[model samples]
Target chain A: MLEQYRICQTTGLRVFQSTENLIKANAVVAVIFLAIGGLFGLSIALTRWKAVHLLPADWFYLALTAHGLDVLVVWIVFFEIAVLYFASSVILGCRIATPRWAWAAFALMLIGALVTNVAVLMGNSSVMFTSYVPLKADPSFYVGIILFAVGTLIACFVFFGTLVIAKQEKTYEGSVPLVTFGATVAAIIAVFTLASGAIILIPTLLWSMGYISHIDTLMYRTVWWGFGHSSQQINVAAHISIWYLISAVVLGAKPLSEKVSRFAFLLYVLFLQLASAHHLLVDPGISSTWKVFNTSYAIYLAVLGSMIHGLTVPGQIEAAQRKKGYNNGMFEWLRKAPWGNPAFSGMFISLILFGFLGGISGVVMGVEQINLIIHNTIYVPGHFHATVVAGTTLAFMAVTYLLVPLIFRRALILPGWAKAQPYLFGLGVAGISVFMMGAGTLGVPRRHWDISQADAILPYDFPGAANLMMGLNGMSAILAALGGFMFIVVVVGSILFGKKIDASTEVPIAPPEDARVVGEYGNEDHPAIPGTIALVGVFFVSFILYYFVNWKYLAEVWPLR
Target chain B: MSVSPPQQKIWWNEPVPKSELIWVIIAFIWGLIMFFAMVWWHIYGEQNLSNESYRITAEDFSAKTEAMVEKYKVREESGYPVVHPPPGEDIYLIARLWQWWPILELEKGQSYRLHLSSLDWMHGFSLQPVNINVQVHPDYEMVLTITPDSAGEFGIICNEYCGIGHHLMLGRMYVVDERGN
Candidate 1:
């Protein structure tokens, strides 16, 4: 197996053929689901917009169910499996152990994904994403999810096996790369997430089959969100790792401080799981003490972890830029940086949007008192879209741009469109998040098919501003759909029809040569990059202002004594 | 660009950057402050949801809510009951499929302990205009002490997805002036 592994000539990294094949397979499936999920997302946005009302009631629910499963579960998890494999085998310069088991995992995932989607499309499981108890769906629905989670669990185990192989092989000298360490964090979280899913979904399957008489609603919500919210936490770790990997692989940027960064990852393992408490903040069964303790005490540590990543990722980039002699003014380094590279631009956009829109809003909404205002509103979706779509999905798209040329040995088709696609997509997603949050602030419900409620026995009308904001949401969704469409076209076209490149003599996409100068731990050799410091200051100010604004908004919500 | 693999360094024992370390410390301090602030708000904030909740069966709560509605039956309309309970008392609101039962009428500037429970599935007690949202779950009664500051008709929409008619699940609360008209 060691003899069969070959070095990727372009990047000079070891690539096991089985790992390469698995990466290609999972990434391709992930993209296909992204395309399908984006279609369902577009339909959902249109239906919720109220003016268009594209899908009928039943179809609206169906599309919503599919959109959640396809995007949130299938697309993200499949891509993450690819990331796990790459980080383990390729980055560690080790041949993947148990290639047969890896194949079995992939096949199980594929079958599970297809089974779940078919079940959803069959119109039997319109329980939406949470699938709260007593609103039972078909038995196939539970089976589909259980199978999918089991497959992902197997994949996570396979990832762990490869890590053991890498350790035995002594692929790297002192330590695994920071990106691999971050993926390890993600894989660990995935095991926890998948196990939580089994705990809830197995009994759920039994109940759907009448094996169990009743599934306690409160218990189901508490346990199920352990699975649901932790899945997003996995995304957070994975995408942040991608951010680090892209900065290193694309810009040759080094971690400003590896020790602090690794500590942040450690914080994620200990405290980030507490964020599942934010979902339960407004629930009746939970006590205030539990809610406050989990949401504030444990959750803020997780926020601290994100805040560290927020500062260091860009700080590393800025230091690298300055080292390249771009350090002239407050922003000379930033201005001179590579803006045309899709990978770099997409990642930078993801960082900014994730911090400002997603990160800030998340902390605000997680507050126990303020949560009463927006828990089940469109604001919930708004925050997650910022994190998941803007942060994770966009980051994934950015890396896929690199993975195409690097892993597929093909040059990207439509380079110009690829460069512009990130901006277009980022802008559209930003609009959707903002407009949705604005509408939610005006008391717009989240999962309602129509805000108008025109067909109700007693008709009701939302505020005119809500109507207008939703209309803007509709327009933004269209723009985002176009961007999504462009992404699919670019990636699929590149994979299918792009020109092949000779890796032996040429590397088309290249980073700055001396950018990856990671100094020793606690080394204070690098000068302070003033621009990053200033930018971080600005981020802090924005966070403070937004947080206070929410408190003020909560203050104004009819002073209840 | 020369494509070379990055040199692997000590993973766990890397030296920390002074600035990043400072930032981490500041972040930790900020998190602590935010935690304390949450404690402060829950204690002192006027907009806090009720901490006076207790567990109860769905059937028992429904029966109690029915008794209250019968005791304070102001009118009946369209197979639904409308109860106008007096101010400064325990107000019962039952959430069922596609409607919040017994539209409650109250007086402005008066606090009422509003007990909310679900009959079949989970529902969201979303009071619009006021912009207060809380989850209504079956088998557990949630108590919210609310004071209507303004005299107007506020809509109570079930924000949770209950079933096909979740959108239609609407209730109204009338906060009236001193005349109680």
Candidate 2:
């Protein structure tokens, strides 16, 4: 039993051996998938750039299908599973429940991912991620996805089981840690997301195998997005959890109000999944009332939840900084922050970009009327790249900087590169998001081999600016790929060849003195966080302006009803 | 803080920060406003998408489109019909594997009930230059009462990925002045 547990010297949390190994396995595999998916993404971006035109039409579609599966589904889900384990066992100082079952979950997920990749590469399953019915992929493709979803479902159970174990053993006092609570929210959302996946994909599998004669196309889209869009909701919950964890671990920041933050998470549990309706806003067979109600998340309660998080995350950070004597002015705390630390810089950047770009654009386009201009355009991808890539992916990348040192027990190799990685990647992805949105606004189609309409019998010439946007997007993707390569190298190199850490190894940064006392309330005084409030004020202004701008654009379009 | 258990035994009873409380109230109000704005748009905005749709077979939809084409096709553009249906009549646009068949001609400022459905896989009805888009799915006939505010030659691009040759799937619409240019 002694051998089953080891105390982490850096944070002093008791890490369960099985849990650590599971995290390592999941994280390493997640990175491998990121590399594969990133490569596919790069090729697709190049092909979209008319000047480059890197891949043939068939290959472009193939690359797109692979890219969506590997990145959107595989890479993010794998990483999220790791986060679940970490938040449960590692943070709670309890042994992971059913370690053997956890291992099986990992194996099943790995196999499923590989099978799907094989199916995609076989040149038959190029149905683009939605795989909307009549356009069938190989039977194996659906089988792989179903298996993967099942594995994820099992992992979510394991997380729940671990939570129960922590409670039974009385791992700590009071409620579970806020990070654990947030993780619980993510796990609950994941269960719902995977159930939706099963509901649709099982029939899709049958249809692909010719066991079913026909599948309703509109029905497939409506149900698939329950799986599709909600999967990103899982990302939102998981990444927000990471945002809290990073703020706590790196800056010793406490939630400004735990009640508010946790309530926001609860809102996610209740209403976030309704965002699936956002995709169907422009589709037929759905009522405007259903679309309006569901797309706004039952009166935008979920948006309110996000708004609360947006304020509290930075608010807590500001409060923490002020307590450390950076209270000279509203801007001093931010100006004097540890910008050189990749963990802090990456988290901050993720917060700002996700709010401004992802959060704002998502709400703007999700409007029932406004969706007509943006649905299925490259703008849709642009909006998500901001949310998933710049927002969730960047936050994930930020946490990895800390995870390497804490879990891997190795100093991050290439310190300078690690510091620069987030900024480089963030800038590149932001460019991709902005430029793609610009092109999309100019009526550029997504998932097309050629926006130039080169081979069309009746070609429509896009504005010169649209071509410029694609070229810029291609360049930005290359830059992001380089940043991604640096991250992989730093992480993998550290795991293999960097100096190993022991109990006596000196950690460069220390938590705030109060944080050293486990289970203690660190921010009892509740220092005023004027800086964060001002920042959030700016965010609100921008969001309002952008929302109205879209409404203005909608008014300009030809009248329709 | 988050990595550890709450300092208070019962965190729910903790006092809410005035600032956070204020912000939450503000956010909730904003959310309500955003929701009402969409509802407001449906009543006041002219560009709202109609929920008017019916379930029709692919074969049935094709037959209606072909009948309209035979009746109103004045010319052929690249093997597809250049259909000039009278204003206020129902116009049929069929989406298929790789094309949006039957080029449409309409007078400016005229309202027509436009019908869109796919004969095969799902497609996107992306009318460019004015840049309006809607999803086109098989067996679901989506109808829209559209009045072209600006008259010109407009292009319909399939934004949704149907398969390989998706980019080549283009259809045209010519909105002429009263003189019928």
Candidate 3:
């Protein structure tokens, strides 16, 4: 049993060999897919840019399909599986449950991703990620997705099993670590998400192969969103978990109120899935009542959950910094933070952009009536690129800087490039999100091969500014692609050839102290988080102003019922 | 503290911080306001999506649209019918693979029960300039009562991708004044 585990020199955690191997395998495959997806994303962006219409129509659609699947589903989910295993087994100090079965799951996911990519490249499955039925893709496309979903489902069970093993072995004291708890929440959401995938994709698969006669378009959309949007919900949970984990590791920060944080996660498990309604708000065959209720997630309790997290995460960091005597001014804690560390910089940028751009725009367009103005527009993609790419993807990239050293046991190569990577990627994605939203507000369509309407029988000219937005978006995509390339090169090169950590290796951050009873704060009632409070105050004010501005925009649109 | 197990044996009994508690309360109230605002908009706001939809066959919707085009046809432009339907009438619009068939002309400030559906695949009824977008599905008829408040030539672009030719899918809506200019 002792031989199965090696004590990590930096953190002093017992790392099981089997679990480490699985995480390494998953992370490596995820990076490979990220490279592929990032390339496709750059191509599509260039195609959309009227100044440089890169790909022809057919190839553009095919690239779109491949891009969405690879990045949104394959890359994120693979990394998440790695996250799930690490959170449950490593954090809890237990062996992974069924290591061989976990390997089988990995194999299935890898094969599935490859098959789907091949099918999409075969040119028949040019249907966008939604794959709305009656516009059928090749049968293998559906099969590949099903295989991937099943593998993910198995991985979720492995997570749960590891949790059970941790409990049975009495690995920890009272409660699981907050990061593991968050991962538990992610795993629970993943189970529901994958089940929804099976419920819709199986029938869609049968229909594609002529086994079933027809699938109602509305029904397909309704159920498919249960899979599609809920999958993003999973990303939210996982990434938020990483947020807490990164803050804790990098700054030794603890949540102000464990009860509040845990309750927030509980809210996500209960109400986040209802976000599927955001996609269907402007669609037919659903009632306004259903849309309002579901989109709001029962009076926006889920949003409240996010709001709480938004405050508490940075609040924790501020409190920690102040404890270290950086409380000279309101922004001193933030200014004194480890800006040179890619982990801290990446995570911080992600937090800011996700809240301001992604969170605000999401609520605005998610309003039932307001959806009519921006649904299916480039604004939709703009909103998600902020959340998924700038927010979640950047956070993931940030954590990689830490993980490569800890798990891969190799010094991160190109430290200079690594430090700058988050800014480049985050700013580029932010530009993409903001500009796309601007163009979409001017009524630019998303997923179109050309915005210029060059081949239209009766072309309608968009405003001159909309063309400029696409051009800017194209440039931003290139910047983001460059950042993505840096990440891939740094991560791959570090793992393959960078200096290995040994007894002589210099560990920058001090090893964390052993867990001990946390004493009450100096006040015992009010925590000194003035900086976080001030920041959150700014967030609330911006949220209110932006939200009402959208409502004002809604008021100007043509009256409808 | 998040990466390692909790230091407290019973963290459930940990004292809640005033800062976090206050923030949660504020957030909860804001959430309530956002929820009620949607409901308020439904009651008082002029703009809202209609819940009126029916299960429609593609062929049936297509035939109805053809009939409306034939009845309301004023002229032909670029091989498509230019339809000028009467105000407040139940007008049909067909969304197909590469076009929003039968370009529509209506008077500004007049309401129309615009019935929209697809013939072959799902498409988006994205009326530009005005920027009123809605999802159109095959086998489903969406009835939207819209009042075009401004006079202009509005473009209908398919935002939902149908195929390789999706970008070329264009339709037009001309909202003129009482002068019909």
Candidate 4:
């Protein structure tokens, strides 16, 4: 029998209980947002393939707006909040600072999401959520942005409160637990992210209402991207934390190096927050110098961190399988790995897909000149979908199978199906990504209601290719939708109809008994803080300080009027 | 299709296990091949533009003469609009959403390449008769090589939003034959 960790209760409250509930609540919301996003994407595919604007151009724009907010903003961010809470409270062996405040924060974000979604559906603001300047929308959209920001900021505060209390309580030993450590870093960035939102979005909102006559698009774009790009990093950082979680759950493993993993995560805090200039690479106003520094060099730091994780992941699998007594050649452990484990398969495939379609494209597209051709192409969304949707979102889904029984206190309703959802979604996503690459390469632009309409001005033979790609997109999207729906059924059914699992019978993953190994991070005695991240942090902050002081001109003309 | 499993083998029931080195080597080779394929495609594809033209518009084309024509009111053998712009000539064409502005007005047997660009924001410029979708970016130009394979009133609509009047940004391209050709 495995030695299960006891879920101790204090004052009639389970420490892990609240975080699990929070995660489940957020996941349900993620699923709903996912469904809405998937539907809109399907419509887009239909519009392109069938060459019919099933919805009007206005509604399609509305759908596009809702899709961005719901999937990119609501879906991912909300899930991050849940993941953060879990990382802080349960994974760190600490409790939420005030569970009430956390719950209240969730409610606030939920309400904000509702308000924004309703406003979008009403066509009050189809400004693409980006709400780029000069192209104005109604006051409600801006208000929705403020409300959402406030909600997210408050949630960050709750996380901060939790972290401080956990620190005082000394929940874990010297270094923070890996998951909590990562979540804390993301929460830290959230402060800057939220502040940037206020800096730009609030003033822009005021400008929209004519409170202030005008705000330059250039100035607004910079600060807004401070919020925008940094928020994406938060998503990515949070995603990496989930990678650890999934590895442990699916493979019964731990990260290869505790210090190295933490270092990678911490690098995100220092470097990635300033890498927002990547998006503005092709924008006319920003200087090539700023673009080069921000897009290429700064981005490489995050990529390096990811690379560390990538290598470390395989290292972990090797170590874990070695523990399983696979004593053959170096690669024999890999051969013995639990390939049938759906979560494991999902993680590997997601890693591969994200690395190629997401990471490589992120670097390539960030190039200033290259972005001129592909900035507004469908490729942008394609890249994000690989990282956010394929990588992080799927990783979280994989974790649910392990977490549901522990958190919900029930076994998965259909464990078999739970196992299959990951690969199905992965395959479906890969197919969609491959198809979209075709559209993007040909410069088939994004945000379209109908391709046939555009085909009118294009040469006669071009629509055939575009339409063919769209058809592939449509097919893959439908497959993804089906996969998504299957996940919903499995997840929701697990929560509702699952068999009761006794808390006393939890499965435990402990280091094997054969060999007593020394911790590499601990100086043969205790855990050591890796120097890489701290050193990088110093350089990143110094670079930012230098740039802000010297290149004040970039702040003004970045976004263009 | 999935690999069929036999026995209780750890990774498929093969006695002679596949080497990881093999996988890595194959991956490397595949990467190289894909890189070369892409480079070849990009270089060769752009250079071989049989439909290349500086400007083909609605004012300078006629079917009666084999030489370069100066009026769009001409039909080609395929029976469609042919608006050929002579070298060094700049022209502006007005169009609404959801309609095609044919360079050759109801002229059939036409095959011509047209340069499309939107005046403001983003617009989808397509020449029916020939299935082409060239994005009429506000500032950048897109080339469309269209040979109207058939005759019909091919409709056009704005794929991207210009403004509230976006839906009515429709145009029509009529493919018809000329009397002489």
Stretches > 4 Å off in candidate 3: A1-3, A506-508, A511-527
Give the best candidate by lDDT: 2
Interface RMSD, in order shown: 3.0, 1.4, 1.3, 13.9
DockQ-based class of model 2 = high
What docking class should model 3 receive? high
Each candidate: chain B TM-score: 0.88, 0.97, 0.97, 0.47
lDDT of 1 at A193: 87
Question: What DockQ score does model 3 reach against the true complex?
Answer: 0.81
Q: Is the docking of candidate 4 incorrect, acceptable, medium or high quality?
A: incorrect
In the range A1-561, model 4's lDDT, one tens digit per residue, is: 211233632111134556666777876787677778778767766655664446767777788788788878887888788777777766656666666777777787788788878877888688775776655777777777778778788778878887787679876555555667778788888888989988887777788789887565456667888988888888777766666666655454555455456667777777787667766654433555566566654535665676566555555555555656664654666667666665676676676677666766665565443454445556666777787778877776666655666566666766677777877888778777777766765555566655444433333333467667778877887788778888878878877897866645544422333122222221332212222233324433443343233223222211111
Residue-level error in angstroms, candidate 4, position A248: 2.9
Model 3 Cα lDDT, one tens digit per residue, B1-181: 7887666667788777888889999999999999999999999999998889998888898888889988989989999899888899888889998999889999999999999999888899999888999999888899999999999888999999998789999999889997357
Residue A350 in candidate 1, Cα distance off native in Å = 0.6
True contacts kept of 3: 0.89
In model 1, which runs have C-alpha deviations exceeding 4 angstroms?
A: A1-3, A297-299, A515-525, B1-15, B77-79
Per residue, candidate 2 scores C-alpha lDDT tens digits across A141-185 of: 998998888899999999999999999999988899899999999
What DockQ do the predictions score, one after another?
0.55, 0.81, 0.81, 0.04
- Residue B174 lDDT (model 4): 54
Q: Write the per-residue lDDT of candidate 1 for residues A472-503, one digit (tens) a residue.
A: 98888888888888899999999999888665
Question: Whose DockQ is higher: candidate 1's or candidate 4's?
Answer: 1
